[model samples]
Target chain A: MRVLGVDPGLTRLGLGVVDSGSPTRPQLVAVGVVRTPADESVDVRLGRIAEAFDQWIDEHRPDVVAIERVFARSDVSTIIGTAQASGLTMGLAARRGLPVAMHTPSEVKAAITGSGRADKRQMTHMVTRILRLDAPPKPADAADALGLAITHLWRGAVAGASTPGKEKDVLARRARTTAGTGLTPAQQQWARAMRAARA
Target chain B: MRVLGVDPGLTRLGLGVVDSGSPTRPQLVAVGVVRTPADESVDVRLGRIAEAFDQWIDEHRPDVVAIERVFARSDVSTIIGTAQASGLTMGLAARRGLPVAMHTPSEVKAAITGSGRADKRQMTHMVTRILRLDAPPKPADAADALGLAITHLWRGAVAGASTPGKEKDVLARRARTTAGTGLTPAQQQWARAMRAARA
Candidate 1:
């Protein structure tokens, strides 16, 4: 399955496409960034981002879209822009009948590097190794986009599979590393319940 | 000039349409709310809002669109949703090549009641008086939406006018009541500069 991952931002949005041949292996299809001038009006910047998203989706035609979930706890100033950018991505994907999955920073880290608290350097290194790229993707955001795609492939596919035991193992591993997941109380409870059910 | 005001929100988006026959006079064309259930996914909610905005713009054929300027200082949980909704509104307006104006809560209050710090009751009263309506509009969001349209009509038009002196006088009057106008530092400076130039 091919997945397109988006790291949403107002000034610079990162996009990556990955084709998963197996649950353990995924190949990079493409990676790039769409930048909008900070001087531009919000609407104009959003229009540019929307156009970029349309072009990427049309060209890549990924089976699913994965995006970094916007959280309120982060830098308050950029939250609104991040959310708006993420929203545009999701809306565009939905318009095309594409299933979209949102992965938090921690979730992406854990899925890619086996630690929710993994730093950017670790994430970049792991993404390079996972994709078997000769060099790491530039501009941390692009690497993050790929990480989101990888996370979705690992978690989403496992969850959808008929193998409940394997799903439980993945969920348990995720739960153990949920320390920095930035999940809401309700979400944490839901995760705990799922783990318990699988147990 | 006809203006469509959008009070952007995820759950209850308010919309108001007004026609300005004169700078100080605006007639209410219509007012309504678009409700999205909390149970729906974010993409679905945004899609519904996009459709509603499209229909409103198509039907009203407004000369301009006015929307509330989103602030990061608001409730953190809702800020993302609010920004997304606002982005959708702006995107749609931009796509149609319609001029869009963003008015802060203070600006809306000031335009409607001549007091930036006006309470909800005062805003409703002024809106009722200004529109010559028998009763105040239901739902505070709808009234605020109308207030936004009125604000844009009064401020945006004057700013773009060829008469600098008249614009300065109007802006000075607004500045006098700037306590609730929520003008950013840059905006305040721009207003001051305009007043000085006219002087």
Candidate 2:
């Protein structure tokens, strides 16, 4: 199935598309970013985002939409904006009847670079190699959205290869490096809501 | 000088404008949000963001633009996207000869709520009281952008309040919180950076 990964930001929203026709690997189809003006108001900025996202949805029509979920711990403003951004992505996917999945920052790193603490440069460098791109994706944020797509594609393929009796839970693909490591209790509650939305 | 504060995100970019004539309290002249569709391609998203931002700038000539700075220590994709988002805001501000200032999540919290660990509800509540608004700003994220503007005004006021023989370093605020403890070298380095950013 075709997949679209998104790195959401109000000022710059990144998009990457991967055509997963083959079970083992997906081909990069397109990647780009959306920008919002620093001068506009919150409502106007949100409107701009909606319009840009709609155009992409109409063009790609992907089966699955992957979004980078923000596990916000502090900064009420940051978390609220991130949550709104995530909400916008999910709302659009739901409107189109497409399946949506979210990957945490840690899960994304482990999938792309084989470690959760991999830096941005490392993730981009690895993405370029794995996808065999001509150059690293520009505005690294867009590249990251693409990376999320790649991670989901690869994990999905790995799942396809596993035996039915021995398949692992999709979320368990990464190992936590720190003790007491897990989504915060509140975030876990959000995860349940997201899962239900996907179902 | 007129200042614009932006709370960036994918689907909604919140923008708030305040002309802090006295730097102690800014007058709120404008506020709004920009929205985007989920399906747009990367390029289209960028276009919309630029177009929207440009339109807003043309309408309101802000002398300075303050944005919530992205933390680079987190996930690479997020860091990259945040960096890109910061670039867009900075670039837009530059186009209009407006100096740009970036504040971290913690600084904004401490400036507004008197605590860096304050949650969204608390910040919103505080911003409302500070702005003397009839109600909390809608969509929560928008309220935050406004709060950032309020913070800049208050911070500037404090800076302006010093006389020839007087000074008000952020150390006083720090001492309020760190009254009994000594910080490590690394923490001291961070404190300097945080102060320089005026966050």
Candidate 3:
């Protein structure tokens, strides 16, 4: 399947296309980036994002869309950026409610580089090596987009596996056995590992 | 050096202390959990965290504090949980004026396993293997606490001898770079690693 991977940003966005029949590795189809003027109003910038998404869809005709889910942010500006990035991604695949999968940054890094804590250079280098690109993807945007594509394939490799939560169920049972341990079984995190296994 | 590792949670807070020089992995001098009833007010829970922290410090007297830093939370409840957790951790550490170091969850995971995306089971399993424990630490809260401890030792072993900036820095850089392509060299995340090697 052809997967469209996106890395959203305020001033620039990265886009990439990859073919994922090969589980161990995938082929990079196209890698490019989009730049938006940050000084514009929110509405205008969003319009640009929408327009960019439309263009990408028209060009890639991806069978799947994979996005990097945004998480905790304190600053309003950053939160806005994160939402924009995440929203733009969702918007692109919104039509027909495509089966979009969002992976955490750690999940993506781990899938791509064998380490959740892999650095950008590591990720960039891995994306280069994995796709067998002649050179590193330009700007960091292209590399990240490519990483998203790689992450999608890794996720697809084992999508419905048991997760960390199953282990939580086990811990819950243990807590019940140890009653008055002041620990509730459901509250036990070990059992939760089953869900992580799924992730 | 003794490093105290903490895995913060709003409901159940975990703390661990390990000595850095004992072996390849630090010895777990002490570990325990503090509980806060959801029925209690936030301040009371925080007070509970404080009391637990005081008890641990008095008993363990760890030389350094290593905490898992909070990340972007999308849910209000989760964000609140994270904020409470952060406040409790910082408040407890600050009261003693202990040197505190924050590592993102991924960093801790990476430091423990080669992969940052390793779940709690993987983490717990690895922790048992790395610490050479006779039995796996029961209750993931405790297991996570142990994992954080090992991560500190691993990073400390390679501390300043290699790259800098925790995984978050790289993720954020990737976020910006992945979204947009106009990353300035100064804003580039890998520049630090590349420059350090050059020097």
Give the chain B TM-score achieved by candidate 2: 0.74
- Of the two candidates 1 and 2, the one with more favorable lDDT, higher being better, is 1
Model 3, span B4-115: residue lDDT tens: 7888776877777777654354566776777779896444455556567767888888876787765454355455455445544543454455666778888877767667
* Span of ten consecutive residues with least summed lDDT in model 1 chain B: B190-199
Per-residue alpha-carbon lDDT of candidate 3 for residues A1-199, written as tens digits (9 for 90 to 100): 8888877665777788899754444788888887767685433554566567767788878877777665554454455454444544553364434556667778888877778998888988888877777888776667888888877765564442233667645654676788745334433332233233223
Give DockQ for candidates 1 onward, in order.
0.42, 0.02, 0.01
What is residue A53's positional error in candidate 1, in angstroms?
1.3
- The alpha-carbon RMSD over the true interface for every model, in angstroms, is 1.5, 12.1, 17.2
Residues B1-199, candidate 2: write the lDDT tens digits: 7778887655667888877653333466778877667596433443455567667777888766778876545554444334434445555555455666767778789987779988999888877666656888776778778877777665554444332323233454454467533433333553443354333
Candidate 2 is graded, for docking, as incorrect
lDDT of 3 at A58: 84
Candidate 3 has a DockQ of 0.01
**Residue pairs with clashing backbones, model 1:** none
Interface RMSD (Å) of candidate 3: 17.2
Q: TM-scores of all models?
A: 0.79, 0.43, 0.41
Q: Look at candidate 1 and tell me the lDDT of residue B142.
A: 88
**lDDT of residue B155 for candidate 3:** 59
